[model samples]
Target chain A: MPGKTFEEQVRQELIGLRLEPSQQVWETLAVQLQQKHKRRRIFWLLMLMLCLLGASGWWWIQHNTDLAPGHAWTTHADNSTATKTTTTTTTPILPERIQPDTTPSTVISQTTTIPAHQNRDKNDYAGTADQLPVKLLNRQAPRTNASVNQSGRYTLPVGNHQKSALSKDLQREAVPENGVIKDQKSQPIPAQDNRIKQSVTAAPAFRDTVVISEDSKKSVVSAVLRLPPSDTTATEKNTRSADTAALPVPTHQPVDSTKASVTPATQSAGKSGWSWAVQVLGGLGGTRKSIGSLFAAPDPLRAYNPIGSGSPGSGAGSGGTATGAIPVVRDGASLGFEVAMEKKIGPKQRHLLGLSAGYHFYTTQLKVGARTAGTLLFNNFNVSNQTGYYFASRDSLNYTNYYHFLEAAVQYYIPFSFLKANMRWHTSLGINYLLTSNGLHYDYSGNAAYLFQNNSLFNRLQLNTGSGLDMQLGRKKPVWAGLQVDYMLGNLSKQALSDQHLFRISAILRIPLQKPARK
Target chain B: MQDEKKLVKDCLKQHPAAQKQLYELFAREMLGICYRYTKSMHDAEEVLQQGFIKVFQYLHQYRSDGELGAWIRRIMVNTAINYLKRRPQYQLDLSFEDAHLHPVDNHQPDLRVQMKDLLNLVRQLPAGYQTIFNLHAVEGYSHVEIAKMMGISEGTSRSQYARARGLLISWLENHGINDKKDYYAR
Candidate 1:
């Protein structure tokens, strides 16, 4: 009734305002947010990767203590179980896949004129009487035999006994028959492969015997042998070259000869057959717990608006305006590094699933509202009670104030990937459970310490270091041999500050490691 | 097709397109409130921009409560008031002269014409009378509320509204648009 006429008139005027609607200002805001996320992504990712790497290394080096080699002895010495023996032997050999030995060949002759017990052995295969120089190539057991004691750091004597008729001479300085052995007798007669295979009948024929000298304890095997390419491996090599191809069938092969061979690995593996690689990641980024940053908003004016209150747990004040930039913790730039190992299981599909373990050292920090070394703001931590948000407490970490956090987490990993020439588009997702924490730390009146002495908060917070969507993935065609890129996501909670969530982008290089070959 | 002006831009650039989005989101509500506080559309639009720029500049300050549009409208109203104080407008004279006659009845005037047309009639009043009319009739502000807002006396606000309403009624009559109920009776 009062301003009805005024209101009507105003409506017509309202429609007459600027016809060209604009929102340039908000566009800028969106752009700023995107850029911020991208940059922060690089640093936090580094920290997370480092954390993983460090954790894995620590766990591995600690539990993998049995890597040191042990003694070896004859596992196959049963002269009592003699049965009808044959004089002929046949081998199903794929010659097309066999490459010739390029290493210097030694010609040692072994003439064992033992009392030929008239072919008296049941396990013996029927063989032709072509009395050529019979030389037993090494016979290895399958990986299962030494799985219980397979030292990730040391090679052991599992099985290696394969006899073959050859034109070359047989020389046996000393054959280690059992585990790791330093003292043993030397029997220089060409032995049969069946003897070694039978000794470790329970395992796949790839676990080679770690032969030790009868006098010297040094192992004669210098490196892990490379086996002839398997059908699966051959296809995988091709697919790996195709830039965009399918999973490589498992190509692991058993060595055919001791001189030039690829030793088959004897460790129990996850779905992805390859043993987990320990990767150490290190970098520098923003620290979410800058003292100046924690106190940036200065919760002033506790006026009652009936909306809500900003106390400890009842409600969290929007700590401070996000627009305000935080200062640096150190001058040059904060550096953080972590070590983690990932053991891929499951065949090489577009995505690989596995259980990996690692250690991490991630120290990220950003100056909270820049103050010089000798300045009053940096020198003093006397937080004036601008807002009565805290109960009687002297420490700032107890309340949500100036602080820093150091935490470690164990995670399970899943990786998806695509390859471009020389680059790999990789996406890794993982869930990390915090195992230990050096709670929020800060320079409180120059007394830097952890925020909490114990964990009372009941919430599950995952810190995803640098796992995310990768834009540039593969390097070689389908995939070159060794280059990779990994991204990580790091965060503690939903209401976490931007810096609290770590996102990192990294270039990875993996070297195909070789095991000590059989002599 | 979407307006070329409303194209999305890099938010960091503070591009025109971003501003256009902000404007599109709050324009209607902001205008409705702005018009109630200002004397004219020109004043209202200026106040709208002034308010929008502040909202955008401090956009990052907005946290979880999602309804940013509503929050911005309140700012538009305040901006309109601040604008008037910064650049005051001259008030229209309320001295009633020749046709000042006694009221015939206590009943209110009736109208059957379009709301837009009736509003146009009220717009014909000077700036001072327009503001008081809008504050009382549309915003439901008391004379005291209007006075406090414009830095004027309650008496002045009441007088301005009375004058503005009289002129609107006369304007409607001159248009040969007599009160519908009364004309039906005749």
Candidate 2:
């Protein structure tokens, strides 16, 4: 026989070898796999949410762009003067209360020609003579009694003079009878005469000027005109005025008793009002047992040595040196829900400060006896100080500790730079007063001994700092979805053997309660 | 084959029953392979656990063209190699030159030798010899492949395997097993 047959025989025999593994292997594997599966599910779910967020934002942008076609309704209107020469159409910015109707019946297309003298100071006028006669079209206006010519044009009677003559021309064409302009349908257009009367008095120096308000500057013009409308009720007009009253009124313009409103062209400008949001978070919370900077917890069963002794591994804690005596404490699930009313403050309205009230519960599990007796320590006087609790058991059992807290916190948030503009980092600092359970309690089950709980040791006041990388979704009303990691600065227990501080990592979803105002 | 494809599809869907079924099907054979590479049963089981984890994690990448058992066996072999590299003791043993130790015994025993005896005889070789023997003689890897896997030269792999086989043959002879009948032809 060839010498290779030995190798061949060995290969054949060994390849068919089979050995059964212990059950512990599968049990551990199952736990790890479950965690992996959970992480994977969370990851995919977040990705799906992000994709939906992107899609919704895209749809919103598309929808708004379609609403006012071809008009350059710029957000940075202050710096928009340089590009004004190229813009063919410029309209007076409307307050957020006006939801422009797109019906063709209400569409008003007006071409206003800026006189040559007004275009001389480029810094003041922003547009060249070539950019004159800018066509103003309201594609979203509601169906009204505003008369249009055969070609769908609402011709503004041109004049050689300034603001007063333009107002007089408008008054001559659409004359008010008994303070109300009646449509062709003989329907009364309430407040139409008052708006024209107010515009005539409050109009600025330029006849056809597009005023851009800088971040630092209060507005100069507040001439928002509503022509004769058929369907608009008097109550609706009053409501619209009331909504505008909350906005910053330009000091330069005379306040019309009927309506005095100013439009802040950007989202940053509109963020001054209080916006409430509800935040829901869920994740893992654990106590970090450390002395000073080192994470070494003093071993409770340091004196016990169980090696070479008849000790059941499951019944009693494995006894060895100080390292082996360290107790196993598994972190439990943490969940919290809070409702907060916050306002954007500081420069550019980028920071947020708020007050929040919520409920949170944290749990931790330790393996101990089902029922044990041990020395108890309490803040109050105890006559029977000889190991007050029952002890002496070798049975291993899981004891879950629950700490429930009614949290009242003052939170402050600041922006942080991240990978993408859509994904923003928010750093939050909170000073919290949490009513907690009597901190960590001890029980001597078998070889395991010592505990950190005393009634006086529990500290209800805690301060925490947390940060999250949020994916800001939607433009009209944005929602923030992100992962937040929080660390408590103060220990939950006072005068404990180990310095026990809590830390948690959670997935947070924050939804704003109000829609942001837009121009 | 269709049942296997369905099992794989179900496993990919994260069905716990399907996962457990798949683990039960291959775990015994996989554990045996891990045992041959490690010093103790505990180490073998640890490697088996790690290997099974990788199997489930990258299960989506498995194509139905090859046999599922063969694919899983390949993963187990790779995992065993990694486990050996991770531990300092095994790392020391993996040094082929330093691990060339002489056999301690030359006792003559009964003429009959079982497969269990053969396995114990193979385990007596140093870690380098045992790994090379298992990879070449049993796992059917080429010397070049073994060198690449172990980060050694092809010549070292060949020498290790030869020494491993010689030691096993000498132990078999000492145990009074006839090479022609009990060792190879059986």
Candidate 3:
């Protein structure tokens, strides 16, 4: 309705005016909306991936803990039992796998020269023999008093009592040359060895005793001796003599030597052998909290219409122009650092599992208020009475939460040729246990402190999944440099202001504790 | 009324045909509102596209308490204000001497001139005057509300609106539009 006056008519005309927009505007809006939809889809897809990774990681840890190491040890124990029953004399010869540089004379002098009848069926002796570096079925040794079996195979003779005496004398002479046996009196005789010698008389060796000597006096004498199962008296006498002569060498030295010799053999088995790595990672992180009804839109005006309302001069009051609340989040940049140890799994070293502890610090500022209606607007808290409030302040509450977590991760590597360098793509899944949390420190402005004082909200744990490109730093070094993008699953808060996620991009350096020797 | 509600529901579900329909229904009036705040037709079109995008984005926030057109109008006005604040040239200030300058009125109103002519005259005014006039006169926002929206004092808003009105009246009268014509006849 146009008024009589020119001004009123002008106002009426302008209020009702509608100018057509260009056709291209709709197409542009459509394309823009499509892109937004695509972005939202990508975000959800990433979230799904993180969830799957976490679930799979939890399953993997549960499945492998009891199976891998237990199976390997069982098989090794069975093999040791078979080897003990087939051989009569416990000659501690170094295994062929061990390096030749390790002195066999030291091992022989350390071994108890007890005859088989007194020390036979002793589990500790069998275990010690099993651990010895002695080579089984060595074809290189000289044959003396060889026995021909029905299968046409020549068996090495079990040395008689006289050979056993000669072997014992050689061992007694060689014991003085082993300077590594520094503490003779401190070495305690194994209880099993003492029990057998007390029950049975010494039996002179009914088995074979072969003595091999080097030209130099300093050179080690390797003696391969076996005791007969039949002569209990001779075995007891031999056990007593062997125990007296070998009592000077500490039992632990042999074990240490065995481990030192076994290390290279285990290393060559595969990359799957346990090699520890320490990683130092630093990254930037961002956090967001969705505080549901804590920030809601202001109530709309009742029974007010802009089109039906009178002219601008009529002073239609503040009826239809209600101020709405806008949620404003100021996410501060975060700094995070972690130290972790990783172990390779499987024969090909395709998977690396790690346990890491890290500290992450984040600060965020949150504010909810109206833009227009200054301070005179009613406080939404007192909805019943509609208490009038003023000064809609821009002040915000700052929350800083620092947390430390221990995380277990499993990663798979896909190696590819990149720029003539060995580069690998690593995908990992991890679960974090929040060890401790420095509770939310609320720094509120004015009235907000009183409003949010009792809010108890924090995250106890989270799941993380990441992928990165790792490049070997050098051929000689077991160090790797990588660029990683890690996505954490779960809310930062358990109750109020939940639904927060953390994403971190970091450059990582991994250094192996024992560097693999270069080929 | 039922058709409008159903169209909104379908648009919320991202039905393409419904989105096009809603756009066609509101694009014209929203464009007019944007045109009043921007400098050129091109700028107005840009603002209109962005404003419509926001409408669809926050459509779920719209309660059935008010008219859908009014809700969309509020969003478009806010979008225009945001667009002006982002551009350095369109920042509102009262210290400029031209804001204090009064255009001389020599002739009576030209009623024969169409609404487009009046919009052209409004666009010719300075950015500050144009925004305050649109918010106060056409959009029916009070001086207090306009002051808060533009981050200026209520006094500044009243003065700016007054200057804008004077300039528009002068421009219309100069074009020889007679006030004696039947105002209701288009």
lDDT of each: 0.34, 0.51, 0.47
* TM-score preference between candidates 1 and 3, better one: 3
Looking at model 1, residue B45 earns an lDDT score of: 53
| Error in Å for residue A265 of model 3 | 21
Tens-digit lDDT string for candidate 2 (B60-92): 999999899999999999988887786666667
Ten residues in sequence with the least summed lDDT for candidate 1 chain A: A86-95
User: Candidate 3 chain A, which ten residues in sequence have the lowest lDDT sum?
Assistant: A67-76
**Candidate 1 similarity to native, TM-score:** 0.27
Q: Which candidate's DockQ is highest?
A: 2
DockQ of every predicted complex: 0.05, 0.33, 0.26
Q: Which is superior by lDDT, 2 or 3?
A: 2
Second chain alone, TM-score for each candidate? 0.61, 0.83, 0.81
Please name the candidate that would achieve the greatest lDDT relative to the true structure: 2
What's each prediction's clash count? 127, 7, 26
Error of 1 at B175 (Å): 28
Residue pairs in collision within model 2: A100-A140, A101-A140, A101-A141, A102-A140, A372-A390, A373-A390, A373-A391
A49, model 1: CA deviation in Å? 10
In terms of lDDT, the poorest run of 10 residues in model 2 chain B is B177-186
